[model samples]
Structure formats: C-alpha cells, structure tokens
Target: MPRQACKKGSHACDGVVRRNAEPIAYAHGFDWRPAYNCKQWFAEHSEQMTSDRGGMMKRYARPLRLLAITALSVFLGETLVMLLLPFLEPLPQHVKVLLDASLVTALVLPMLYYFLFRPMALYIGERDRTQKSLSKLSSAVEQTADAVVITGMDGVIEYVNPAFESYTGYTQVEALGQTPRILKSGKHNSQFYEALWKTILAGGVFRGELINKKKNGELFHAEHTITPLKDDSGSITHFVSVWKDITERRRAEEALQTFSQRVMDAQEAERRHIARELHDEMGQALTALSISLQTAEETAESPAAAEQLHQCLGFVERLLQQVRSLSLDLRPSMLDDLGLASALRWYVDSQGQRAGFIPQMELDSLKTRLPPELETAFFRIAQEAVTNVVRHAHARQVRVQLHRREQEMEMVISDDGCGFDAQGLQTRNARETSAGLLGMRERVLLLGGQIAIDSAPGRGTEIRVRVPVE
Candidate 1:
C-alpha cells in the first residue's frame, strides 16, 4: 500500500533538500521504494504523526465519539438489511448492493451528525457556560463589602452573604428562614413598618436609615436599599436588600447636631442676660429721672410747665413697658415658673393684645408641669408661631391648641388669614421674612419634635407641632 505524504519537509531532509521540495516517496509504486529506507522514514515521522493525531483526537473527542457511535449504529442496520437481502427474491446484485451501502453511509451519517449529535453537544456546552457565569456572579455578591440579603416573597430571609453575617453578627445558619423583623430594635412602632411594607409591595424601592439589633442584642444603624425582584410573569418573587453599616456616620452626625444646639442655646442665654440688663438697670434709671423731673415741675411756680412734665412722665412709662416686653420676649420667666401651658396662654394673650388680633387659647389634660427643657421649648415655639401670625398672617383671629396625648405633646396653631406659599417661603429671601417660622422649627426639632405646615395660595395656614413627651 502507498503511504500518504507529510505536508511539510521532514527535519532530516531540511539541509539536504531545498525549500518547497516534494517528498521522496511521492509517485512511488508499492514495491519501488526500498524496504529499509521506508522503515527508517516511518520510524522518524511516526512519532510526529502520532502526536498530531493524538492532539486532534483529544480536541474533538466528544463530537467524534458521538459521530462514531451513530455511524456504527447505521452500519449495523445496513448490514442487517444486507443479510436479509438474500431472503428477498428480487434483491440487487453485489455491485448495486455495494453502491447502496456507500450512499447510505455518505448521506445518512452526516445528516444525523449535523442535526442531532452536534446540536446536543452545543447545548451541553452552553449549559456548562451558563452555570459557570452564575457561579461567578454569586461569588462576587458574597464577597462584596455591602451586606446582601435575599428574602423570599413572604419577607423571610432565604439567603444572606458573608458580609451580612460579618456586619450583623448573625451567622448564615442563624439567619436562614428568619424574617427581617429579627433585626428590629423596636425603636419604631407598627406604623413605620406598615408604611415600609406598603411602599415595597407597591413595586417601589424603599430607602431609609434604620436602627437594627444584631445577633448579640447590640443595636447598630444601617442605610438600607430594598428592591423587589420579579419573575418572568412580573410577579414579585423575592426581595433583595443591600445595606451598609452606618452606625459611626449616624453617631458623628448626632454629635455635630448636639454641638450646634448647645451653641444656639448658649447664644440665647447671653441674649436673655443682656435684655435683662437693659430692662432692669437702664429702664429703672430712666424712670427715676422722669420722677425727678415731675417733682421739679411741681416745685416750680408755673402750671404750664407742670403739665408738660406729666406728659413726659407718661412717655417715659411707655418706654419702660416696651423695654420690659422686649426682655420677656428674649427669655420668659413665666415658662420656668408657670409651666408650658400657662406660658403658652400668656404669650398668646400678650401677642394678641400687641398685634390687635383676637386670640383663642385651648389646653386639654396638661395641668401638671413638664421637664424644664420641654417647657421652655414649647413656650418658645408658641411665642414664635404667634409672632409669625401677627407679623405676616394678616389675620383677624388666631387659635392655639395644646393637647397632651399618650407619650406625646401636640400643638396646633391656625389662623384665618391670607397665607403665603409654604414652598416659596423656604428660600433665602422668604427665610429672612419668615425667620420666626424657621426658628420655631429648629427649636422643636432640638426637642425631638416635628412640625408640619399646611398652607396654599389665598388660603389660611395651619401649623402642627408634635414632640415626644417622655
């Protein structure tokens, strides 16, 4: 038999032959080449050919194995047909039989390989690639610094990554099958949770800061982003929550806020002291001078001069009253002695008399005194609110209500006046004119309170303030 030629020149032939030289064995009859030379050539090139063939087999093993099995099955079926040919009386001759078998192998085998075996192999490879990609994604999420938690549709935790365990002190085993409520610190009430669930179930993302309890019962703060994951049918299947531990950030922010509040309080105290000096010291000296002028006029012989001194004394008394009012506005002694309710009523009545508006005061279930700080905060807010109404509201009637609810104090002030735009009143220019409202809000916030203003164009405004009583 004639052997195939190697495509490239052999290494042994490289120096002896020029480039593009043909193999020495080409066109040689079966017996023409010397047996010894043939054996030597075979020995030299066999290893290289064997190595190349082995690499090709390894690279195409899966598809080739499948093709071989399919081909063998077809060959066997054709052989069975040939064996049964003798039983048929009109069977074709050997030449026709050989041609038919050749045609079946050539046509049927390649079709089966292309349509069935190749597609199956490609699908298997693709599935493996998909699995590898999913594994990489899972590993990346697990190693992230942010806490990753996946919960079932029912809000029960199904999976939590290593970062979540590290930040929350809850191991995977402990957190599995647990609800997020396990981390609740109880700082917020049921209403808060209701709102959170409402927003999330409506297919909206929820973002907020929460105080959560860890596995060891230590509380920590976290900024959380929760998103609902949906299936192909657009139904929510799970919730993915990404959170970062923000305990230190929250602590630093709170420290800064406390420092700022302390500075404001100190400044207010100094202002109160100065106002007292002006009203008591300077005001008294003016009164004495006015009295002496009246005495001197009475001792004089002229009646006209005595009348003028009396008018001067009246003006002096009015000046003293104005100074006293300024001092009281700076720091009211009534807030410390009479409590928040009485102080608020006094402020409303005094502001009404000054601004010429009819003031309506209502107090419910606040007969007892409160903490000094609370009393002062409430009094200041009331003072600021009434002042704003008088200066800006342009109203004829004002109503102030103070009510003590369970664990909270609620105050509302409403006026029948031409109210300005609340949103527009938040800018720099509006703040200058509405400094009283801003001051009231700051004071309420310092006392752990919230204020809400309801107003629109051409409508009366209402302000509601709520503070924690405990």
Candidate 2:
C-alpha cells in the first residue's frame, strides 16, 4: 500500500496519496500513479475494487477472490518449478526438459480454469436467473382468483398456488403430494372420473362441471378445464387444470328456471279454474233454459211447432253436456277436494261410463297422508294416463293400483287395450296421441317422481309412478 499527506488546513487534500504517474482529482484528494491509469490496474481489473457497497458484495466478492487466488497460484507454481530445475538439475536433456515443462504449464493451467471454475460460474448465473423467473411466476399465480393446479400424470398434486389455498382452505404444505380426489364431493361416481381420465389420456381436452368439497366440508361448484401436458414425444406427462368457482352463478340460473316454471304453472292453473267455472255455472244454466223452453212448447196446441221445439231442446241439451265435459277435462274439481286415490278412482269411473271401459281398482294399504301438491300431481298424472288409455287403447278392462311402501307412494295403471310400442313412442315426436303421455310425465317430474311405461303392440299398457314420501 502507498500513502501520502494532504496540504495543511485543506480538507479536500487531507490524507491522500500521490505516486509517479499523473495526478487526478478524486473526492478526497489528488493521486498520481500508473496503476490508476492502466486499464488492467486494481480498480479496472479487480471486481472487488469496483464493486458496489451493498448486500451484493457479500455474494460476489468471495467467488472473484477465489478466482484471483487460483490464477496467482498457477503462475507462481510454474515459475518456481522452472527456476528450481535450472539451479539443481544439470541433466543431459535439459533443453527438452524445459520445453516439456513449458508445454505442460500452458495446457494444464488453462484447462483447469476452463473446465472447473468457469463451468461453476456459469451454472450459478443460470440458476439465479431461473430462481428469479420462478419467483415472479409464482407471485402472479398466487394473486389470481382462478384456481390453478399442477398435477403429475398419476393425478397427484405437485403444486398449488396461494389462490388455491384461499379457495379450498388448504395450505400448500397440507395438500402437496396429495391426490386431487381430496376435493371430491362424492356427487359423481367412479364412472365419471374413469371417463374423464380416459379422454385426457387419449390426448383430448376435458371440460366439465365438478361439485367439490372444501376442507371444512362445504360444497362448492366449479367449471373446470383440464388440459393434458404432453412431452416432446406427445406422451402426457402431467395435467394442468384451471377452474373457476361458479356456485353462485349456477344457483342464480336455477332460480331463474324455477321462476319461469312457476309462471307457466300458474297460468295453467288459472285456465283450469276458468274452465271449471264455465262448466259448472254457465253450462247448468243453459241446460235449465233448454228444458223450460221444451216444457212450454209441449203445452202448446200446434203439433208441428212442438216437434220443432223438441228438436231444438234436444240439440241444446246435448250442447250443454258437451260444454260441461270440456270444462271438466280442462280442470278437475275432484282433485282438489279428494285425495289422490279418490280422485283417481273418480276419473277411472267417469272414463268407464263415457268410454264404456270399466276400470278395476286395487288400492290397498295407503294409510300415509301425502302433501297436497304431491297428491294433486299424482292425481293429474293418473287422470291423464287413464284418458290416454281410453282415447287410444280401446281396451275393455283397465286396472288402477295405489299402494304405499315404507318411504314411498306408488301408483300403477294398466289397461288391456290396443297398446302401441312403448319404446317407439318414447323416441317419436309428440302427436295428439302422445300429448297425454307428455303431460303425465311433466306432472310426475314436477313432483320429483319417476314414471315408467310398459307397452307393446298387442300387449297392454302399464304405467308405474313412484314418489318419495319424504
């Protein structure tokens, strides 16, 4: 090290050094030295002399110092070996020995630095860049609202971001190395997952709705897109899933659907009420007027006129009956006052009277009281089914059965009529004959019930309906 003193009473010139080179004004004082001017001198050539005074110094300084030390050692070792050989070994092959030593030093020193130290430095730099990029990507994924997950080909979770943790109430530490089945809600069976995996393994994308359960056992809905990540050879190596929680949206859509159905149902109910009123009140008055007119005409003396009046009265009476029948078909009052079984019996009996097909009824062990809406639904379904049988079946004998089990109510209606193909009817477009069947199915579905129809060309038609009591 070299030192110099400043001029007296000058703070800028205090404790500075000057050497045999040109003087340059620095922050503290002026210095003149060849090392300050040379490009390969201390400040220019050495990393430590020009390094920033921060946390970065601790990381960079040690490696640079090691490199410098290794270079110096190689230089000194070669020089010392050459000097010692000339002083001690006066060999016959001195000239060849010196030539061989020079060649060895030149090759070995550079090979050592290139293979060992240079590779290590490059690897460290690459690793640092990779770590920084990964950190940035992780941060972005954590901040997103969508649930992103990376899973191995075996369907086990390898990584989950903070958003996943917040959404599922599971920390990465708790969920890592676990299978995605941890989020299963048990709503879907094994076949669902089997098909999903089959599609993905075939290099196809899968999109679906999944009902998942959280760590706290709360159920949520998600719309998920699963993509198979393939390697260069086109084999699936992993799966990347991105999903959004759509539970609230789904609930809103369901609510809208329910509202629409209710509106339709209300309109139907009002039409039925109007039809019933017309049949019961206006139809009866019309019949009474026709009967009184016929009585007055019968009391008159003109026989031809009386005959015409009688004909008019007869036509009017038939018209009244037809109107009443139409009104009753539109809406049945019996369904409201009576239970399902009684309403069904009344409908069957009325059909027998009109269509000339007596329906046998077997209603045993129906002691449980059903909900009013459910009762009405079941009665309407049976009525529609029976009407279809009367209109199309042309059978003489029909059987209606209403039975109760431990947790369910069942109604079965069978007719020995000209039954059509049940499977064909199911697949065909609805016509006048199938309209009644569609109505019955709608009623059953509104009550959350199941209906099954059995029929063949020559075989009788049988409809079985089951509604859960609870």
Candidate 3:
C-alpha cells in the first residue's frame, strides 16, 4: 500500500506549509506522521519558486529540445563513421582517427543547422518581436484618450478601456457580455444602423458621426470608426471601435455661427439708418435748391443769365435722383412701412432695371406682416439669392415665388442660367464665395429654417428657403 505525507499545519501557500507546536485543523487530507523540514527561509519563499518554475520551463522547452536533438545527431554520426573507418583500406591509426572525427564534424554541423537550430532561431525571434509589439499596443489602448471597445463578432461587448468607462458612465463589471445596442441613442434611424452593420459585415470599415447615449441616458455626439477583426480563415471574429466625444466641439461651432449672424444683422440695421438719412435729409435739401434755381431763372432779366439758371436747375434734379437711388440701395423704405412682400416687389422691379431681366413673380397669402426679425431674415435671404442669379446666372429669365402659410413661409427662386456647383460654394472660404451662399444659409438657420440650393454646371440654378412665421 502507498502512503501520502503532509505536515500537521496550515498550507500557507502552494508547495509550502507552516509548522507549529500543536496540530491545526487545516492539515487533514493526508497527514499521519511528523514532517521533517522546518527551515524558516524555505517556508517563507518556496511558493514563489514553484510558481515560477512552470513559466520558465515553458519558455525554454523548445530551445532545450533543439539542443538535445542536435547533440544526439552528432553522437550517432560520429559513432557510425568510426565503425565504418575500421573497414576502410589500411592507414595509420592516428590519421584514420583524425579523419573519422573530421568527417563526423562536417556531416553533423549542416544537419544541425538545417534540421533544428535555424528553424528554431527564426521562429523564436519572430515570436518575441510579435509579443513586444502586442505589449506596446495593449499599453497604448489602455492609456489613450479615445474610447475603445472590443466586441464579439455577434456584437456582444467583451472589453472596454478606461476612456470608454469614463465617458459612458459604465464600469467594467457592468458592461461585459452585454450587447452594444444598450447604448443606442435613438437619434439615428434604423436605416443608419442597417447601413453601418452592412458595411462591417461585408468586411469594410465604417466611419461616421454617431449620437450615442450613456448609462445615465445623456446623449452626446461622437466621431468613430469601427473596423472588423478577422481570423486566419478570413471570417469576421470581432469588431474594434474607437471613438471621441465631439459634443463640446460642435457646440462651439454652433455658437460661432450664431455670433456671425448677429454681426450681419447689426450691419444691415446700420445700413438702413444711413439710407434713411440720405433719403430724408439729402433729398429735401436737393429739392429746395432746385426750386430756388427755378425761381432765379424766372426773375433773370438777361437771356444768358436765364439759360445758366436753367442748366443749374437740371444739375440739381440729377443730384436728387442720384441721392434717392443710393438711399434705396442701402435699404428700401417700403420694407419698413409696408412689409416683406411690398419690399420684395420693389426690389424685383429695381433689379429688373439693372439686370435687364425681370424675374417672373408669384406671391401668395402676403396680406399679414410677419415678426420684424423674421421679415428681415426672409428679405435678406431673398435678396442674396436674386443677386446671385443676376450676377452669376447668365440666363435671360428668372422665376421668383413666395408662399405664406399659417405656420411657415417659403420662397423659391429659379433662374435659367449657367449654374455653379453647390458643393463648390460650400468648400470655398466664407468671404471668398461671390454668391453669399454661406451668409444666406446662416440667415435662414438663425431663424430655425432650412435653405436648399439645387444647381449644376451649364444647367440652371434654383434656391429654396423656408422659415417659421412666428
């Protein structure tokens, strides 16, 4: 019969036990005798050695095997050659011995290199390099600012880095093995997700802006890219997603847009004030001068003097006309007194004079006036759209339509001219675009409305704008 041995004390750790004067309750499995070793040094540290021996063995196992195989091959080759040397033609014993040794060396060296040493060297070297790179990658993922998510092929969350936990209001314990759909914000439609899944399943990377919710249900915007991970068989194994929160950046951009709109509005108001000054003060003065010159011409006794007074009065009339034209250019009085519709009609007429093509006009339900700020925004947008048509659209005809409803107002202007690219307008620097497309967009957007432009090169251009009446 075989017997098991143990110490009558606690198993302080693996491969280690402590002894005391009295037997303890823990040492019950196989102890029937007194244990022998009781060195304090070994008792304190033997557990660490036992754990490390397994790891070190695995590390050196392949190289040790290679060394053993090479040694055996050399021994077998030398022994076979030495036996064959005895049968060969007679020679001096020392020389024959040397010859056999040299032959064995020559045969065994290449065999060792080709069969074991070179292959092990190449494989171990590559594995070590790969492991180091993987270690670096793991560290970077853990410390980076961008949120990183690793999920199973079926979209089950597997791992999330620190940044992910910080922004998502989730801890590692709460997120594992859950579906990523738990974070859906519902802002993106089903089609959006369908497209995203389709791209990833097809082995393509998906990159886009997303609106995602956190654990506490706060929605935020993120710019993210999701890439598929594949196994050696080229089948999708998992997904890696990296994202950054862009909520603050987007808010700042929106604030900047608002500030720009305010500046534009103030500038327009100042122009209106200047226009009123020109019309009321300068026009009246010029009219009075013309009247005085006419009276002088009537009282003149000499013909030459009367002729000169007549010429002077004509100059005064021209000057008055110039001042009136300039006043209207700055701001039309009809816009203030009547409303948006009246002002638009007058503008169409005035532009017709300059461009030699009066746009075909249509107006509907224009009886009630809108709020002052809304009216101003609508007018400015229409003005810019029409001006672009006259300056850039070389077409001989234009169409302008304004519709007023209970809840909203919409304007559509179309021209049959050489149209420019809408994308080109968007890409150009804000100040460099000649059409004022960006300014027009800002105006309508500030009013919580949408503006759309349909244009194509060598074709025609159409601009549409809608704003809420309130």
lDDT of 1: 0.77
- Please give, for residues 1-470, the per-residue lDDT of candidate 2 as tens digits: 35333345644532333444234432210011121233323333364334445447887876787677666766676676677666656566877577657756775667567756787899899999999999988888878889999887666788887878988999999988887878888898766876787777679998999999999999999998889897644656788888889999989976865775586478668867788778878887887889797787979689888888888888888888888777766666666666667767777898899899887998864565577667767777777788787778899999999888777789899998988888877777767446677767766665667999999998888999998886
What would the TM-score be for candidate 1 when compared with the true structure?
Answer: 0.64
Over 4 Å off in model 1, which ranges? 1-140, 153-157, 170-209, 215-217, 234-236, 264-268, 300-315, 424-434
lDDT of 1 by residue, 166-223 (tens): 9888899998977787788988776677677777767999999888889889999999
At residue 62, what lDDT does model 2 achieve?
Answer: 63
The superposed Cα distance between candidate 2 and the true structure at residue 355, in angstroms, equals 1.9
TM-score quality measure for candidate 2? 0.52
lDDT of each: 0.77, 0.75, 0.80
User: What TM-score, over all chains together, does every model reach?
Assistant: 0.64, 0.52, 0.64
Clashing residue pairs, backbone N/CA/C < 3 A, model 3: none
lDDT of 3 by residue, 235-263 (tens): 67788999999999989988987897779
Off by over 4 Å in 2: 1-174, 179-211, 214-218, 222-253, 425-433
Query: How large is the C-alpha RMSD of every model relative to the true structure?
Result: 25.6, 23.6, 16.8
